[model samples]
Target: MRDHGIGHIVGTILDAPENASVVKELKEHAREAGFKAGYNECLSHVNPFYKSKFTDERSGFHGVDTKALYAAAVDTYNNLSISAIDDIEEFLEAENYVDRLRLLYDYPEEEETASGSKEDAGTSGTKED
Candidate 1:
């Protein structure tokens, strides 16, 4: 688990007009970090700005156990700051809801590390991205 709420913070910062500079820096950092896709994927899953693909009736994520994920997101949002943008990939690691699902389903880990972090080495093939 990487902290607990980077993902929620990312969405919050990305939406705040006062954080434009911070968002700019965070976007550049995300690209350099190799977890851009994962961040985008995370946003697509939980960010209201992104309208969350997972919330779509046609999305495969539909009917999945997102209660915990949403609750965590809400809790995270309640206590976020601009400074939390660092180590954004940890957002995915925040709740591990998706990771847990993948693990439970026996999804094989891809050799390529999405975030170039040892912790995320097994996070490929999530398909949600």
Candidate 2:
């Protein structure tokens, strides 16, 4: 049996931010921005961010779970940072929140080694120059 439970994993994520506060803040900002759907999408990223802390090798028999979570995280990031937020002003307002969420989720720099260091991380996703 696994020593760690889902509750423990969830706790680690929620520990950084009171879960209710996160929801309240995101809902208020996203709802006012006329992107309630984005709120749901943004909030959904937390699961994978936390879960990605566990690697496939560490996951034992449930390695697929780790892979799935990581994939979900990447997909969510791409969606939000690329497609979800369209307007520059609206996207700018929400990007900070999403960035915090990514940090809180413990985004894996090691896993993103192909990007060559976190500082070098670049994407044409949502921001406009």
Each model's Cα RMSD: 23.0, 23.5
| Candidate 1 local lDDT, 7-83, one digit each (tens) | 44456557765466544544544443434344446757576656434434544444444445444544555555654
Q: Which stretches of candidate 2 lie over 4 Å from their true place?
A: 1-4, 15-19, 35-129
- Predicted structure 2: lDDT: 0.41
Would you estimate the TM-scores of all the predictions?
0.20, 0.21
Q: After superposing candidate 1, which stretches have Cα over 4 Å from the reference? A: 1-59, 84-129
TM-score of 2: 0.21
Cα miss at 2, model 2 (Å)? 1.4
Candidate 2 clashing pairs?
Answer: none
Q: Report RMSD for candidate 2.
A: 23.5
